[model samples]
Target: MAHKEPPSPLLLVRGNNRRVAILVISILSLLAMFFLTFSPHLAIRHCGHGEQQRSMATETMSFSSGNTNDGGVSRRQARFTDLNDLTATSQAARNEEHVLILTPLKNAEAYLPRYFEMVNRLQYPHHLISLGFLVSDTTDRTVQLLQDRADELLNRDPPDDDSSSNNTRYHSVSIFEKDFDFELPEDRRHEFEMQPLRRSFMARARNYLLSAALKDEHAWVLWLDVDVIDYPASILTDLQSIDVDVVVPNCLRQTDENESMGYDKNNWMETQQSLDMQKKLDPDYVLLEGYFEFLTGRYLMVDMPTHLGKLDKVPLDGVGATFTLVKAKVHREGANFPPFAFQHQVETEGFAKMAKAMGFGVYGLPSYLIYHIMNS
Candidate 1:
């Protein structure tokens, strides 16, 4: 009889509320199970998309950062997107470019004083220029003289009032000594028959100096022969303005009363005869300019009239290192003076051939003359 009395209004209301709460809880549980079964695929898709975007961003960053080594591209190729960009930076910002001046010396004591004087007269900021020398196979006091002069040039004190004097000191000086153990009697050094052997040694010396002195910071390289007696103070600027990968001024022999004649025939353009002759010769046989034995009839830059404008440039197939200017990237890309025959030429001429083969322009300024001491 007491159980039958459970039909009270308050009790009925409480029972309905409990059933409603339980039904709501059961619906929520079913919804959560459905979400757990499908939501993992959606979450994975979103995360995968984000990961793909991050990978693409990382690859773009690597390319712009010049990390070409990882991509198998050369540093030289990565630095300039286009080869034509090898031209020097604007003249207004020329001081920003660092130039390495390299000289390969052999018994050059007699010329060091004049060479230093010429170096001192250069209008290019000395602080932007580094000096490098390779002393190879010498019997003279060249090393001592070079050391003494380097000391004087580097250690010279500037007058307190001269604000520009600090820029007169070279950025750095590096002297390297290595002997090739090859020698020619002084009297026969320039003989036609001895030129091949002599120049091969010279090539080895130049390569050694370049590899030793070339630094990542250098933008240009000036290969200067120590025997050059005279050049314009603006030679560096003049050559750079030509905007070629490799350029040389006409090398002339100094004569009494300042008259000059072509001294370096190494700078020449190949003639049909020369090419034909090269094909017939042994691959190892080297060619020579200014020699009667191998007459290929190549046109010499020296033969070009000197009355041409100083900045006037002509394409060259070969070049002499006597006051040559090269873009540093050219050497970095593997163009160098071959000690053996390269395209039937050796040393400086071989270097020109190599550069041209590598798709770089080689040129000469016929009227931009630099004087070489008369060979003894």
Candidate 2:
């Protein structure tokens, strides 16, 4: 405009480069903003998908392990602060309580078939039940029979469809082999004279099984004898409904005739006479039940046939484990079947005494009957 010379080529090139740099910077800034605005939503969707997959896997793996002595507290157990809240209920809601069914076996091959049959017949959810067996000093094929039964139940195919009602698979099954070296002839096993030593050995076996098999996930411990043949399918829920720390049902010996006689005299209420006997006996003296030599005058559950109400609960000072259902916390809180004399009692009775000493209630359903196999 004022006689200016033509612009230099080098200067023109430098200006064009500056404009290009600015355009590139502007595009990069806009792309970063777009990613920042939407990244959180994508991240949240991915994280939720991962969590759902983990939950489903955990449910499928629950108690599928075999023969574990780990007894370590599980994450699931830690999540439960009060197991009583999960107690069995008759309400329409699902039953979340986990029950451990423990049995002590000695030459029990004959009973295993019927025992597992009875277990299968139970109406309680099998997925919520775990089985523990202690095969101590067995001369028969009890261990093999037990293993076969466990395999049959655990390895069965799952239901064909979600709507199928047949589900007999147990949550877990554990088989423990320990020899207590206690043996008696079949004919003389129940002799009153053999009671003390026999019960002492039994106490040791029970203590061993309890320690080896009990797990933190178990909400309840059910001591069911292998010889027990017949019970209501609702036995678990029925006992749990009582909600006592320790509870037992009257175990009656099965008869060819329809007569009902109490078979487990161990379920008794101590009398003042029994207390006096305990005070006079040596600290090591173990008391015997169902014998006349040491009649402590205790009230026996089997003797209470008149109280036949299914739900009638009677406070007990001693309990038999024939069909006992105990809150797991009772055993966790240091109540166990004493291998030694405890308050002049041993075995299951000693367990009751120990539980009561720990400030837990002991009870029995005097008229609620569970049948024991008839022994000749």
Candidate 3:
């Protein structure tokens, strides 16, 4: 049987040809499968087509993360050390009696320079006073201008000559720009921005500053508007004269009338100085109604040594927001007039009512009324 297997060479050659043909067919089948299964995927990956598709998708997202509630401490409020305790300790150790001037502003770039100039020109003891500027959303260059002015003030050297030499020295001026409504929704932005026109809102904003002023332990708190200029040397003397819980210095609102209408057409401004002038002209000016006397809007003084409880419940008239002073202790104990009146109510009638409610008398500091230029 072994001798029979080596009998033919032709038989061995045919068997080898059959084996080669089967191997060629298997290789062609594997190549066809590789092209069919992987070509499209490889092309897409090579051209970055998958990544391009991902890039074409668009999605928008908004985020809201900040202090939202304006009412009071929240349910989840953090436990922290009470500032009052620190304030008490600091108050005991304080040497210098400081005054805080809280000034609020909006888009008042054109008016702020004059206001700062007036404040700079003040004859009060600058070393004892500090200014706090409260600014809201200002679309214009008001904030920038204010910053520039602040830089100038920071760089200013003492005057070479003292025209009205007293104990007056330059005090510190601070600018606080808060975005009270910065995160307001697009639809609610207008409403939030306009809330200042409402009396309640104004009261709240002003009261907020009172807490801050108290925390700082200021000896006095003065509220001011950004539009008025201070009289050259009137602030210091005016502050020294108040003895009651609150003092309302009159203000002026300058008006222009056409000469064609005769004396009625004459331009006039009821200023802070004018109110003091009216009182000088008549001691019973506040008592008189429809007396046609102008009240000054540039100066107001409050004796903060007494209770500020009246501020919480009082309804104000159209009082000016300039040259008003109060005691820091009173404000710390939660005494503040409703701060949200548009323009003048809190400063006028609201201030008066609050004072009366606390069994405190209101007096006019006629001598302290600062000369507020109306047309400037």
Highest lDDT: which candidate? 1
Between candidates 1 and 3, the lDDT winner:
1
lDDT of 3 by residue, 1-376 (tens): 4565553534455766867867887999999999998897465333377765654332111222344453575433332332353221123114455667787666777787677667766555566677777666667787788788766665666566654543344366666666556433435523433333443444555665555544343666677667555454555444434434444444443345411111111112235564455445432123211223432443222211113322222212223345555555445554466653312334234554454555554444332333344441
- Note each model's CA RMSD in angstroms: 12.0, 10.7, 20.8
* lDDT of the candidates, in the order given: 0.84, 0.82, 0.49
Q: Which pairs clash in model 1?
A: none
Tens-place lDDT per residue, model 2, 1-376, is 5898887644565756867867887999999999998787455324477797886556554645334443474433213233445443332115577889999989898888888888888777788789999998888899998888889889898787724554658889999999977779889988888887888899888988999898767888899999898999888887777778888998988578977777898999988987877788888888888887777778898888655689899899998888998888888889998878888888999999999998999998987888987775
Off by over 4 Å in 2: 1-95, 161-166
- Compared with the true structure, what per-residue lDDT tens digits does model 1 show for residues 29-73? 999999998786455334577797896666544554333463576
* Model 3 lowest lDDT segment of ten: 258-267
Q: How close is candidate 2 to the true structure, as a TM-score?
A: 0.75
What's the alpha carbon RMSD for model 2? 10.7
lDDT of 3: 0.49
Q: What are the clash counts of all predictions, listed in order?
A: 0, 0, 40
